[model samples]
Target: MHDEYNVQAGLNPRTVREYDEAITRVSLGYKSVDEYYSNSCSCHVVQHVRIPLLCIQAANDPIAPIEATPYSDIKDNPNCMLIVTPQGGHLGWVAGDDAPFGAPWTDNVVIEFLEHLQKNASKPESS
Candidate 1:
């Protein structure tokens, strides 16, 4: 499914292969896939990301399953919200039958969240 999404997103197959090779070369020192996957330094280090985080997870996403998402940790953070949709296969919620790109729902939800954040941010702080 991820492969299909990559292809659909206009990623050249050769480019994908090159990316895989790059990762493989960089991971040569790792003892195992688990070791590579478990490395904390390898993950994105976002310190004090003040912006509100809205994580949208598709319940049926095979690539990023619900259990795989660090939702509990995200929700525990002061500035984060996790939304899980029951449908939409791994970023497959293409909006409108004739739409050229990704799902309409994705845009709608993201926009709504941003608007809400903006409105709330503009409000004067209470003494």
Candidate 2:
């Protein structure tokens, strides 16, 4: 279903099945797709990210399954922030009071977060 959306949205030039076949032949070197995804997939690379990363995931996103999220790694990492909202399917957090500037809710979130950082940037460290 998510693949259908991607193809319909023109994010991918080929259908999901064709994309999978192309991935298998050109990108994934392992015999099994699971093994290739386990090692080379972007979803599995969060543990290696070294910067402050804010990840926003919808609890009911049809495109990205909740099971694929790096819950444990995000919980264990100080540099990672994971926000799983009950809504916002596939980056659709738009119409809300928080969205004051005709921007997406995620944009508002990042704007507020950056404001917080800027406001607190000059404070001294607490012992």
Highest TM-score scorer: 2
The alpha-carbon deviation from the true structure for residue 51 of candidate 1, after best TM-score superposition, in angstroms, is: 2.5
lDDT of 2 by residue, 1-127 (tens): 1112223323454444345434542343555445645665446677787867788999988656577787988888787889998987887888678564577768878888778777877888889
| Residue ranges of candidate 1 with Cα displaced over 4 Å | 1-31, 40-49, 96-103
**Residue-level lDDT tens digits of model 1 in 70-102:** 654675577777778898777877777678475
For candidate 1, give the lDDT of residue 34.
44
lDDT of each prediction vs. the true structure?
0.60, 0.67
- Model 2 TM-score, all chains together: 0.61
